[model samples]
Target: MSALHIALYVTGGIAAYKAAPLVRAFIKAGHSVRVVMTAHATEFITPLTMATLSQQPVALDNFAPPRPSEVSHIALADWTDVAIAYPATANFIAKIANGLADDMASTTWLATTAPRIVFPAMNGHMLHQAATERNLNQLGTDGVVVAPTGTGFLAEGYTGEGRLLEPAAAQDFVTYVMSRRQGRLQDVHVVITAGGTQEPIDPVRRLTNRSSGKMGYALAAAALQAGANVTLISTTGRQPPFGITYVPVTDVRQMQQALTARFAASDIVIMAAAVADWRPARVAQEKIKKQPGQETWQLDLVRNPDIIAGLGAQKTHQFLVGFAAETQDLIANAEKKLAAKHVDMLVANDVGKPGIGFGAEDNAVVLLQSGTAPQYLPKAPKTTIAAQVISAIAAARTPD
Candidate 1:
């Protein structure tokens, strides 16, 4: 899966110690984390420290980019896939609840179009105060997802409510909230194929493409975040993001069998895996050893089943999306596949391009569908492109 862009807002509180683990958890799960802290939060934990852990420069003040061409706060807003106020102090919560944007944290919170998640932490009485209660309710009214405060020992000697949530719990809550956002593909099952299926020529040798499964994994994660029931079928040894039903396959036959088993239950099927077009016609009982005099060898090849075309022809209610990676005659070839495969949409790209597509982190593609005009996706992170692709498929689905 492509890395998630997280904007974590840190505020002053003893619970601030928990923020480090929070950031670590996000990173461990393959998300990109950036800390944005209030001035007071600096006293509890150093910006340099958080920056080191997150591997991103912490934003302590909201200002324009050093270049003076772009507004820094808005840029952050657009960059964030989700905004989270971790260990939010009562003061910080009140400030945002009252429409205050005096600091970078508040300003970024106010500006972001992404979902906001707030973790309120403070002394029990402070949290129980009528004004604080009102502010918390106000935030809820504003559609901010608030995690339930855990009751435990406060910073003081006396025990009371207001403990920061456990890092793992907080992480799970954030993921759940993000999935519940608007336009969720709730109840829809999406089956996606990823990676390059290996065609074994012998026990020790195999033929495979350059696919790393980054784009397909990104699509699976994006679909999950969109609240779809995602089942990922992958051949690459790469890991998929959390929260998916994964089916692992190695060769052409296994991939075909996996897709056949899963496709019947899916609402959308994306054929992103670079399945081998041909396989060795004969299988050796063991690894084929080379003789010292053997300079040339011949192997017969046979065509593998056209998985996408088979699905497209038999698909009844499913939205079938196929992929084409061509080096020449791109448009005409993609259009021909779009028709011949009977796919609803085809995502095509030129693997010959430099630094994009085919195992790269970024890609540029042309989307061709039966009805809509061709849509071009500029070179960007695979996650962003996957999100757009998932949305287009969702938008095109016929209603019950």
Candidate 2:
């Protein structure tokens, strides 16, 4: 993530002390922060403390010791890239929701064009009050993000909801919100498949490949960081990170079924799973046993359905991406599959090379698109590769 200019608004509440760490967290993450505080907030945590942490003077008054050239509130509002209200009291929440900017903090919020996030910190009862709920809902309608209050011990000597989030968690929430705003694929629904599918021959035996599902998982993570809602379908048992929808499948048919169910609603589909080309024509209920005279056994195989091609044929508004792990004639074979599968982009790599493809942590790939020359990406971590692929997809889908 890139550095950001963050405006932290401190409101009155016992949780106001938490704002200091939040400021440090943002700065630690390479963001510059400027704090604004309400009168009640000053009682809980001194402006000097915030100023010392943020390395900037805190804005505490609408008037007094004013600048000669510009209004402080408006200047701060205009300078902000993102606004955050930490430990927002019920009074402050209502004021912003209703556009009552009696104080400098509220006024700056009203005047700012940057996106806003509110972290309500009040008594559990006050937070769930009808009025507070209505105000929060109004803020949502006004395009403000309201962070959910954590449930835990409160200042009222009781354990319940409406507790402030820890500095680390709050920082994480801010990062997520900021990423979504800056992300090119914001609100895009993406579906990706990973790992190698298995074709069962009998109850105890199955056929699979060496694909470790690393590349596909990388794509899912990259897309998510780019603010796309992602669904990951995999045969591997690797646990997905938070914020991705996961569906586990064991074979080509199961993967195909999962993809088909989500294809219509997706804006982009990436076929990265190394699906089996063939499966046993019949599955035996029990494991095959060796016999005295049986030296060799024959298994009947049938072609598995081409998953990507089927989705491409049915695509209405989705951008399709397919992957090819080839051993020889990489470019020619990949290009052939690109056109055959009807994908918008084809990512082809030579699995024959050691330490780069299949189960390797790094990859080198040639990106293929219709009528365009192959673009080679040097060997790099799969995460880096995935980010580049997502960036390329975003550029292709929304050309200037």
Total backbone collisions, model 1: 0
Work out the TM-score per prediction.
0.64, 0.73
Task: Report the C-alpha lDDT of model 1 over 1-400, residue by residue, as the tens digit.
Answer: 2357999999999888889989998998899998999989999999988999999999988653544776778888899998999989999999999989998899888999888889999989998999999999999999888788888877887888877788887886777566755445977899999999998888889888899998899899888888888899999766565467889999988999998988888899999999899999988879999899999999899999999989998999899999999998888899999999999999999999987868899998899998778999899999889989988788778534
Q: What is the C-alpha RMSD of each candidate to the true structure, in Å?
A: 9.6, 5.0
- The list of candidate 2 runs beyond 4 A from truth reads 1-3, 12-31, 37-68, 98-104, 150-160, 163-189, 195-231, 234-250, 276-304, 313-317, 326-333, 350-363, 379-383
| Cα-based lDDT at residue 306, candidate 2 | 90
Error of 2 at 156 (Å): 6.8
Model 1, CA-based lDDT = 0.88
What lDDT is obtained when candidate 2 is compared to the true structure? 0.92
Q: Compute the lDDT of residue 211 as modeled in candidate 2.
A: 96
Query: For model 1, which pairs clash?
Result: none
Q: Pick the candidate with the highest lDDT.
A: 2
lDDT of each: 0.88, 0.92
The TM-score of predicted model 1 comes to: 0.64
Which candidate should be chosen as best, given TM-score against the real structure?
Answer: 2
